[model samples]
Target: MTTNQRRAARFNKAFGNRLAGPLLSRMPGFGAVLHKGRRSGRVYRTPVKIFRTAGGFTMSLPYGPKSDWVRNVQAAGGCQLVSLGRRFDLVEPRVYHDREQRVIPRPLRPLLARFKAFDFIELRLAPAGAGRAER
Candidate 1:
């Protein structure tokens, strides 16, 4: 990580959780990615900037790919997305940089583009008939 990214991560860890996390996690068009710690086995809920796609949801990784939640999700191979008052069992995790920003909303694209936040974490919902649990 660059110096700026390291600093930003520190700031997010110190303030984002206490300030923005609770509010963002519950709002529409935004949700929490639920993943478990690889070693500790502790559950973590991370607030993310979410965009709906044809198949599932795409989220911006403001803290970049090195974020703990990202690693946890990748390690577990899936995670739960709590959004729209529903809990979805998301599978087939994919992380990449969408430089064209095609999946991002038009209004937010410019702002996100400023931060060069092209790294994304994508999760597709499990098939409808597959049993899943609620929040």
Candidate 2:
């Protein structure tokens, strides 16, 4: 992360996200990941571009793998996702860096590339009725 990129990121987090989060949460191919902070335990809902795959879902790490939301999800080993008015339990977070962005859908690759989102996170859906009896 260069100095300028860091500054821009901070600016986006402070202002841009406030406006974007709500819109993204409701958009197609986008979703909100709900996870708890590792240290603070406070929950966070982060907007992300998520695509369903054969096994699970893949998300473009636009802010990179070190983003707070990513770290929290990784630490917790799972997170809940809400998209298109549906809910999902995602587990086994795997962050990978790929220049080709092969895991991303064809039409959306260009947009993610423009954002320098080379890193991606993949998660598999929890088995059906898994832990249903727990709660």
Highest TM-score model number: 1
- Using all chains and alpha carbons, the TM-scores for the candidates as numbered come to 0.89, 0.87
| Candidate 2: residue pairs that collide | none
For candidate 1, the 10 contiguous residues with the lowest summed lDDT are: 126-135
* Error at 108, model 2, angstroms: 2.6
The residue-by-residue lDDT of candidate 1 on 1-135, one tens digit each, is 678988988888688766888788788888888889999999988888888887778899877888988999999988988876778888888999888888887888889988879899888877877646475
Residue-level lDDT tens digits of model 2 in 16-135: 667787788778989888899999999877788888898788998877898888899999998988887777888999999999999887887898788788999999988877631112
User: With candidate 2 superimposed using the best TM-score fit, by how many Å does residue 117's alpha carbon deviate from the native?
Assistant: 1.2
Question: Which of the numbered candidates is closest to the native, going by highest lDDT?
Answer: 1
